[model samples]
Target chain A: MKSVMIVGVGGQGTLLASRVLGRVMLDAGYDVKVSEVHGMSQRGGSVVTYVRWGDKVESPVINEGEADVLLAFEQLEAARFLPYLKKDGVVVTNTQQIDPMPVITGAAVYPEKLIEKLEEKGVRLTALDALSLAKEAGSQKAVNVVLIGAMASSLDIPEALWIEAIEKTVPPKFLEMNKRAFELGFHA
Target chain B: MKELLQGNEAVARGLYEAGVTVVSSYPGTPSTEITEAAAMYDEIYCEWAPNEKVAAEVAAGAAIGGARSFCGMKHVGLNVAADPVFTMSYIGVNGGMVIGVADDPGMHSSQNEQDSRNYAIAAKLLMLEPSDSAECRDMTKLAFELSEQFDTPVMLRLSTRIAHSRSIVDTVDRVDVPLRPYVKNAAKNVMLPAFARPKHEMVEARTVKEREWAEICALNFVEDNGSATGVIVAGSVYKYAKEALGDTVNYLKLGVVNPLPVEKIRNFANGLDKVYVIEELDDILETHCRKIGVEVIGKDLFPRCGEFSQKLIAEKMGVARDESVSIEESIPVRPPVMCCGCPHRGLFYALKREGVYVSGDIGCYTLGASAPLGAMDACICMGASISALHGYNKARGAEAEKKAVAVIGDSTFMHSGVTSLIDIAYNRSNSTVIILDNSITGMTGHQQNPTTGLTIKGDPTSAVDLEALCRAIGIQDVQVVDPYDLKATRAALKAALTAECPSVIISRRPCALLKTVKHKPALTVDTDKCIGCKACMGIGCPAISMKDGKAVIDATQCVGCGVCTDLCPKKAIG
Candidate 1:
């Protein structure tokens, strides 16, 4: 069984990334279950989704320290959900930062040196500026696809299957840009 | 073919495949998508009823008219529809009726964590709880059949985890079942004192027979895996236990949670060395086990609040896993906030500045109670704003009328606020009401309401006029103001509050998140004239922040609502 945790601010396309991953796992004949946060939590709040796939899956949530991969779309969110990762878990994180309400209102300061902090915890970390890479692919909204591609590099699934899943999941109007974004992150 | 489906989506598919003809529902989290998805099927007629009570009655009326019908609502919504739900159990159904009530156990988006199983028992209704999307689909179809066979309304209880989670489900072809013929029988349908007395006895008799049938039903079965310890679970908790214990323990999973299979539970417990009951929120199953002379371990080892995870179950059962790591540094909280250009922001900001005691209602506007805004003083439920405001003024007399107002959204005013407005007019109170007209239901992901001039499928419809409705309800003083224009809003609020009779101020603006709305240019801060007074931060707009001791607006996040610009004392914002 494999478990992946996607963490990001609300409206950052994290849920779409999980949906695409779910489709890829289902196409491979694996039993997949995806759990998401909805309602008030989607209003510029921290959103986390759990995707599990295996021969037969039961629970839709991942236990603490049980995630095989952690895909984060923001720097603070990546550090916030670090406890969900296993000791040897692979981390594919975007270096983009979106300040929380407290930090924005001057109640608190945004944490600094997040990558260095995670590296000190002895986990396998791969951090990149996915926002810039997505822009290079012709749309900044394709950052989720970029991170998904980076996460795909650590898995045994073929790049073609990921691309096929992306094609089926995204709208056709922006398909080419997302495809380029995925490839750029895959080779990052 | 198999497809990934949310639990709510599967329930709609089940309703479609069961040949249901009519469906009605009011939007609420975890339950809204069921009706939205049902509307996609051309075979069924679906609608967004004003409130849960009306939705339930509409489905019941359709059932009485010889159509298989269903209605969906969240846990609190059931409370609003309980009057119909409780009586419908005695009246029974003519065709078939299924009520989908999704419970929020962890209170994720709800005001309270309630167990809907108690409602089923109180109403003496049969209830089915599904753990996954597949069961959600299969059990919904079965619920309709059971409703017809037993001559009763059935309840399908769903929790947050089960309702929102997605899992693979195999699609099934629709079965066109002919509608049962409707016959007028006052003795069964009417609830007058003499007629209802006999029907109550009949309901009790049916419960006894249903319990007997539950004992042998295939839905309640045992799985023996050679382990002595046994766990009896139901709904989403069953999935959590299965993941934690695997096949090492004997299990009796119950799909029919209400009118529980007492005999089956006893037989299963007799074969195992130890019996344990696993459930979330409340100890409904544990209480039943004790009443039936069965010993069980529950509640004492498990929590009775919030949700249950696989790890928690494993730890309680003494299963070992690798020790979990923890982060040493504390992280800032990221609570949900209003959108960047939310329509309610300006009205709330004005209300706070006026120092008026505001009574709030449900919607995205309820965020007015959060820090920075802090305008709303009381929020009981839907439509309580108007009614509560009336009572507040009557108690405090003329002084309260000068500083009190009820703030509600357009959709919510259409829901139950109109009735309360009538109460204020008839009883003679000097209460002022502010209707924040955001043009759509801002909460529950912007579903269409009566005031939106569109149906669930987005076809044009007759929109309810707020001014005409207020006049019709006996409120002569009615005014509409653009909430974006703070000056007009302040003037309208002042005139309405000081008025002698009941008055309503409709603060009109479209939700900024709607795709059709165009935004003005993002505002820029002139640092040369900045005073760093932090007045602009009081609105709690996520787009504006204090950076380097000066107000700084993120151009990318701002939608140019410009409400914050009015707060700057030095005119430093443009």
Candidate 2:
């Protein structure tokens, strides 16, 4: 069985990214279960989704230290959910910063040197500026697709399957841009 | 075809396949998507009623008219509809009636962590709890059959985990069951003393027959692994137990949680040396087993609150995993907040400045109780704010009326708030009420309400006028102000507090996140004129932050609501 944890702020298309992954896994004949956050928690709050796929999956949630891959949409969120990663797990993170409410309200400061701090934890990291890549591809919202592209390398699934899933999951109007974004992150 | 579906979506599909002709529901977390998904089917007539009670009544009326009908609500929403739910059990249904109530055991987005199973038992209703998305579909289809067979309303209980989680569900074709012809039978339908007494006896007799059916029902079965230790579980917890214990332990998984199969449970327990009941929240099964003189382990080892995970079950059962690690550093909490351009932000900010003790209601405005804005004093449930403020002022007399106000949302006012407003006027209480009219239901993903002039499928309809409604309800003072206009909102609030009669101030604005609402260009902070006063920060807008002792607005995050500009004493924010 393999477990992937997707972590990001609410309304960041993290759920869409997980949905695309779930479709790819399901199409590949794996039993997939995806658990997501909904309602109030989706209002600019920390959102975490658990996607597990295998011959037969049972629990919908991934426990601490059980995730094979951690897909982070933001730098701070990457560090926040680092504990869920297995010792030898791969981290596919986007180097983007969205300050928490406390930081915005001046009650707390945004953490510094997040990547260095995560490196000290000993997990293999593939960090990139997915926002820039997505912008170059024509839309900033495609950052999730870009991160999904980076995450595709960590799994045994083929790049073509990921692209096919992306095409099916995203709307046709922005299909070309998202495809460009995914390819850029795949080779970044 | 097989598709990945959330439990709610599967239930909706099940309703569609069951040939349900009528469906009604109120928007609530974990259960909202059922009706939303049902609205997609052209064959079914789906609508969002004003409140859960109305939803239940609509479905009940439809069933009485010879149509297979369904209604859904969250845990607390069931409470609002409980009056009819309890009596509907005795009256029964002419056509199949299925009620979907999703319980939040963890209180994830609810005010309380309530067990909906207690309602099933108290009302003497038949209840089925599905473990996953597949069961959510199959059991829903089965629930309708059971409802028609027993002539009772079937409760399909769902929890947060089961409702939101996604799994593969095999597709099924629609089965067109002919609706039973409606006949006016006073002995069964009417609840007068003479008729209700006999109906109550019939309900009890039905329970006995249902218990017998449950003992041999296909929904309740044993998986004999020939293990000495056995675990009896239901709902989503069964999946966790199977994942944790694997095939090492025998299992008795129950799909029909209420009127629990007593004989089946005893037979399964007798076959094992030891038995355990695994359930989330209150241990209804454990209590039932003990009453039947069967020894079982439950609740004593497991927690009575919050949802359970596979790891928790494994640890409690002393089962070891392949890998387990603990981290020392505690992660900082990321609490949900109002959106960047939220209309409620400015209203709460103005209320705080006015020094009014706000009694809030459910919806996005409940975030007003959070820090920085800290305007709301209490929030109990849907539409409780108006009644709570009325009683609060009645206790403290006229002095308290100046300090207290009730804050409710547009959808909520239509739900149950209108009655409370009438109560205030009839009782002659000098309480002030602020209706945060955000154009649509802000929470639960912007579903259309009566005030929005749109139906479940976005068809234009008659919009409820808030000012006219309040005036018609004997409220002499009815005023409207834009929440974005901070000065006007504050002035209206202050005037309403001192008004001799009950008054309602409508703080009207469209939700910032609404697709139909257009946002202005993002605001910019002038660094040259900026002095670090931290006044704009008090509004708690996520887009506004302080950088190098001066306020800075993130253009990417800001929607240019410009409510923050009113708070800046220096006028640095534009």
Candidate 3:
């Protein structure tokens, strides 16, 4: 089983990542089940989407120390969800930070040196300047895709599967850029 | 093949697959999308009622007329519909009607984190909570089936996480589960005391029978682990239990939460060395276990409030709380606030300055009750401000009437404020009501509402004219003020509050955060002529701040509506 958890703030396209992963797994001939934490997602709150795929999948939630990949769209949120990964799991994350409600309200502070801490724990980590990369891709909002692209190497799923998933998930007008974004994620 | 869909869309698909013919709901987060999704299907007759109660009644009426029906709202919506819901429990149903009330455990878009589970118990209806999109769909389909089977309404409970999240739902072919033909029975449908007394007896009997039925039903299942320790949990939290306990603990995962399968639970707990009842927010399950002579760890072990994660579950279960998982320390918190170019900012600033007792309602305007603007004195629930304002005036008389103003949102006013406005007009409380028409349900991710002339699925719908509605309610003093036009908004607010009769001021502006609305160029301060009076800071625009003895605006962040232009008394800034 290859389990992936994507963590990001609300409106960060975390859902799209899961869909793309699910499609990729299905294309690879594996059974895939994707789940998500919804509701307050659009409120700029901490949001996570889970995708579990294998020859056959039973549950959507990845058990503790069982996630094969952790794709994080924000630094603090990645730190917040770091526990989902296995001891030897790889983490691909955006170096950019979008503070959650608690941070802006003075109730908490954004954890600095998060990637350093993750690296120290012997977790295979790749940090990309996702916001800048998304800007380079002509949409700063595509940061989620930038982080998703960084995780493409491990997927081993066909490019077509990713395309189909992106096509199904995004609205029709946004399809082309999202395909390019998927390619970016796949190539990253 | 599973298709990608939004949480709301899947629930709609679930209803469609289940063959629901009638759908009615008032817009709300986590729940709004369900009806919106259902509306897209021509087979389903969907409408947005003025309030939860009306929506519930309409669904109940459809069920009475022999159609499987559904109504959805946020948790607070249940309170508004409780009267009908409780009565419907006694009356039962003809066609199955599933009522969805999504609870925001962390108060994500609500004023309070009240669990809808308690309402299920209070109303004596079957309640099922879906843990994810699949269950959100599956349980919704099942809810309709169970509702008809039990001759009762079923509550399809959802949380913020389940309602808004996307998941892959493998749906079955659409089932044409229509209601049997309706035949009105005066003895049953009409609840005179004599008729109601027998119906009440039937209600109690039905609950007992439902519990017995739940024990054998597929909804409540015992997942045996060959372990002595057993855990009973339901809804989304059930996923947490499954994740944290692994192969060590057995579980009695109940899908139908109401009329809980006590015998089956006791049977499952009989041989266990320890029992734990895990749930989010409340101890309804824990209380049931304790009442039925089963000892279990719940609220006392885990915190009573907020959502839970797998790590929290492991810690409470006395196991390693993810020893391999490392969290970054010293992370800063960022509380949600109104967006930088928010239209409500200046209006709230004026309210705060005037020191008025503002009874706030739900929406982005709720952010005004937070720090800086801190204008609103109270926020009880949706559409509460108008009624609360009336009560305040009645209690405190002239002084209260002079200082207090009821602040509500355009969408919220359309949702439930209309009735309260009617009340104010009928009684002539002389209370000032301000409808902050940001042209969207801003709190719940800017879903369109009646005033926005848009449907939840982005289709064009009839726009409810607030001024016309006020006029219809017989309020002569109705004015529209652009909230971004601070002088006009302030003047209108002042004038309305001073009027001898009940009046309404519509603070008209599209929400700044709305993607459809383009923002003006970011305002810049001429540093050469800048004198830092910090007057612009009074409005609490996040983009404008005092830096190095001069008023500075972050160009990258600001959506320049020129709001701060008037704030600088010295005329040195902007």
DockQ, per model, reads 0.70, 0.64, 0.35
Tell me the docking grade of candidate 3: acceptable
Q: DockQ score for model 2, please? A: 0.64
- Kindly give the number of clashing pairs for every candidate: 0, 0, 23
Q: Candidate 3 lDDT, tens digit per residue, B225-253?
A: 89989888887677777767787999998
Candidate 1 off by > 4 Å: none
lDDT tens digits, residues B1-574, model 1? 6999999999999999999999999999878899999999999999999999999999999988889999999999999999999999999998799999999977778778989999999999999999999999999999999999999999999998888889999998998877788788999888999999999999999999889988988888789998899999999999999999999899999999889988899988996889999999889999999999999999999999999989999999999976555567778887778888887888988899899999899988888888778898999888999999999988999998999999999989988999999999999888999999999887788899999999998999999998999998899999999887888888898999888889999999999989899999889999999989998898898888877799888865788988888878999999
TM-score of chain A of each: 0.98, 0.98, 0.90
Tens-digit lDDT track of model 3 for A52-93 = 777645445665676889998878877777777888898998
Q: On DockQ, who's better, 1 or 3? A: 1
Best by TM-score: 2
Tens-digit lDDT track of model 2 for B99-199: 99999877778899999999999999999999889999999999988998998999999999899999999988888768778788988888999999998
The fraction of reference interface contacts (C-alpha pairs within 8 A across chains A and B) present in each candidate is 0.61, 0.60, 0.36
lDDT over C-alpha atoms for residue B75 of model 2: 96
lDDT of each: 0.91, 0.91, 0.79
